[model samples]
Target: MNPDMSAGSHNGISMVAEGGYQVAILPADGKQLTLYPSLQIDRAYYWTFEAKADNPGDKIYTSLWGDRGAKTIPLTSEWQQYSSMGTPNPNYQYFYFWSVAAKGNVYLRNIKLYDAQDLDIVVEKEWR
Candidate 1:
């Protein structure tokens, strides 16, 4: 986590005991958390993870830097699996999750990035 951007009075990110991470957002606008992950150009990758928020209706916006656009993921109080497929731009390097308008704790687990060919295996073994 980037301390400078993540260290707000009421917002932060932390590891959870059971496995995974918790991102707490302050109850204000424009709160965000960014993650840097190495990605390759012209390769389609499958991004999958399970996530849940502290409250129903909370949401987070996610995207890969330099990708065409972002995705809005809706969260419920229950854990749910989400997935997306994209080919990163040559200079893409960051993965971001933020609540531009809402605020709450979002828990993430089983986050996986798989090459296109390995996606089916992951789905059969982990997502089933």
Candidate 2:
């Protein structure tokens, strides 16, 4: 299916998806989503989002791919916050949100990406 955009809380953009599975690829290019590129090695970075599933167990997760390798965080169905950090590939750069095995629908909004050094500043742009 085609990607869609809709209103979310605080008039922020929200990503809606239905069917089997969907993902917002990263480097979050301006056209797709809004996230920074080229993470520093061994640095602590945070990625957060607000999400709810149409049904229970519609796995939501984040993927980090770098020269070091890859990492994933299993997310919940309820609207909540989650965070994780890992070594980044010096050669590769990017992260992504995945709705795996999603059978019904899902809503995601308020995405934030930042480093531990500064929680006060979000590095991502408004998703489009």
Candidate 3:
């Protein structure tokens, strides 16, 4: 978002993503997102995102990235918050979010990314 834009609103708009395991600066349902990048893999840093569905019938999901084991965290239309505590993966370039799972109106906010101390690249022995 530009300096002129305000939080919780869609203005000065950029790219919008639909769903599932892909990366986007903004989540699908259009909520302002902010980030604090840390390449410090020494320990784990975590934050929470609260999703209040536009419709109570809608079941939503939330997900944050780590070194490994990435998936969507499920939530409902009611006010719900998800917390993550794990050693951030410096190996991964960018974190991703999606909504192909629950399938409903999803609102995402307060996303925090804590990276590892440093990235270690692994080389495979067998070539496919």
Residue pairs with colliding backbones in model 2 are 66-89, 67-89, 68-89
lDDT of 1 at 113: 63
TM-score order of candidates, best first? Answer: 1, 2, 3
Cα shift from native, residue 90, model 3 (Å): 2.7
- lDDT against true structure, model 3: 0.39
Scored by lDDT, the top model is 1
Per-residue C-alpha lDDT of model 2 across residues 1-128, encoded as one tens digit per residue: 12122211112224335343333322112122323355676676666566666666555545455422222333355665554444555655565555555665455555555665656654533221
Decoy 3 TM-score against native: 0.46
Task: Give candidate 1's whole-model lDDT.
Answer: 0.58
Q: Residue 124 CA error for candidate 2 (Å)? A: 20
User: Poorest 10 consecutive residues of model 1 by lDDT?
Assistant: 1-10
lDDT of 2 at 45: 66
Per-model CA lDDT versus the true structure: 0.58, 0.46, 0.39
Most TM-score-accurate candidate:
1
Angstrom error of the Cα, residue 22, model 1: value is 7.5
lDDT for model 2, please. Answer: 0.46
Task: Estimate candidate 3's RMSD in Å.
Answer: 11.5
What clash count goes with each model? 0, 3, 6
